[model samples]
Target: MANSTALHSNITQVSVDSNKNIESLRMAYLILLVLCFCIFLYFLTIILSVYFTTAHIRENTRYVLFVYMLINDTLYLVLGFFLVVFNIYVINLPVPLCIVLVILSLTSFMATPYYLAVMSLERYVAICYPLRHAQLCTPQRSHAAIAIIWAVGFSPCVADFIALSSSVETKYFSLSGICGRPMLIKTPMQNNMRYITIIFSFTMVGLIIVYTYIRIMLIARKLSSNKSSAFKAGKTVILHAFQLLLCMSAFTSHFTETYLKDYFAFFPITNFLLLMCLPRFLSPFIYGIRDEVLRKYIIKWHSFAITLG
Candidate 1:
């Protein structure tokens, strides 16, 4: 009787209509849209606040890093907005449309990890040596460094695109939506590369933690400055690491499902929404509360604008 009941439940699930499935997907996207909009507002608030209150804080290399991060946050949020809207509303489009959206989506995701890595290193240096920091971190160099980060970040997307183009139809599933996954089991080479990514991600997080603690110790030994700076750095790195670590685990689990189950059982859109929305919301909160300059600017700009009105 138990076996029969389980079979009935499975049969009911399989018999669900596409329209109902599509409606459920639409609801999911609506929730994601709200999350994306929140990120947009957060990024916009930072940009506006910074621009309006330029008198408060001069543009230094540290500020430049913050601005770069703001730009990336905006790009990520906007891309996410379009991704959720397009996939949910349109549902199906020409196959080429999928390719175009795939490229844009990948452009955001690929670059984000690298930016986190860069920010980790930046914090490491800022905390490690106070005197040499100005020379070590310059706007010209930071911009160039970011450009390099993007270049390296883009290579994987480029290589994978080339691989997709060159592959025969028999090997894998063709791109059907804004995002697609490899249907076949990963090659040994592919798994090796993913493991490398996992390693590098952890290494970046490790450096952030070690340097943060070391900076704390240095500050303690000399009693040079208050503990707040090191505390702020520690919190930021921890948040970023938590997001990236969760994402890495999700990627590994999704791809590593062996032969018994469907490789593509999960909805790509749903998984992405679940993984990303919380980070987007949390990032702006961290920026506003933790960064004194950002916090002051946000308040002052709004106050001044209201007074003018």
Candidate 2:
């Protein structure tokens, strides 16, 4: 009786351990798969939409700023695709590759918020001071602003690249033929500086939206005679503001995922799809039709399609 009881207890303990190991493995795979799938899908959607949206924009001079926006976004998506795939599935990207990936990833993250700021400021000026709009917001100046935004985003990446290139390999994997590179070589100053840029960009964007919306609301109430124009302008402003706030929320949520969650539960796929890629694609559906010409074109396009069908 004693021997039989001990045998039964041992079997039960083994079964429990097996179940625990299986759960752990399942969770690990889920996290990895989610991260990989989410990033790939996000980048794929952004690149396609960016390409198609800007392809027919003939007036290069007028569309230079938007071109810059698409270019940076394209670069971001392209780079993000590789890093997410390699990091999760392969898990042993080479040291040099890692450096390039990190540079690209950081560059995209830095570039994103500034473009949002520039976009908001452009809308703010267009609505708040239409009299001086032509003089102050010419195509030449727009191009220059876009250039400056990109330059600011690039500066920190350049510094980080210098830091990364100097890193010595800390680990190697013969089977994968890959090596790990140190992440940061800078002190508090560089770290603080980079984050400051992000904070400043997002803040400037938010400030512009808040101030402009308040002014628009008050003006709309007073100038009720220009009600149609005011309504259209107000709608546009709100849409822009909505777009920015949603994007900011997505980014902040992603940052939170790093420390607040466990390794395999990132769910980068679901959050990023809903938050990041969806917004970019969705904004076009909302605002592209708001443009008088684009609205007409879409209507005509749909009619043409219907007739053909």
Leading candidate by lDDT: 1
Off by over 4 Å in 2: 1-68, 163-190, 251-256, 259-266, 299-309
The alpha-carbon deviation from the true structure for residue 81 of candidate 2, after best TM-score superposition, in angstroms, is 2.7
After TM-score superposition, the amount by which residue 239's alpha carbon in candidate 2 deviates from its true location, in angstroms, is 2.7
Provide the overall lDDT of each model, using Cα atoms, as 2-decimal numbers. 0.60, 0.59
Per residue, candidate 2 scores C-alpha lDDT tens digits across 1-309 of 999999999999999997688657645655654565555444444433443565454333223454466566556655654554454354675555665666766666566566665665665565667687768777678778877876777787777655544543444211242222223443555566666766787787778767777776677787747556666766766776777777677666556666665653434543544565555545445554556755565566556657988
Candidate 2 at 185: error in angstroms? 5.8
> RMSD for each model, in Å, please?
5.9, 6.1
129-196, model 1: which lDDT tens digit per residue? Answer: 66787788777887887788677656655665555556536323434543333322134554455457
> What overall lDDT, based on C-alpha atoms, would model 1 receive against the true structure?
0.60
For all predicted structures, in order, the TM-scores are: 0.70, 0.66
Query: What is the clash tally of candidate 2?
Result: 0
**What are the clashing pairs of model 2?**
none
lDDT of 1 at 215: 64
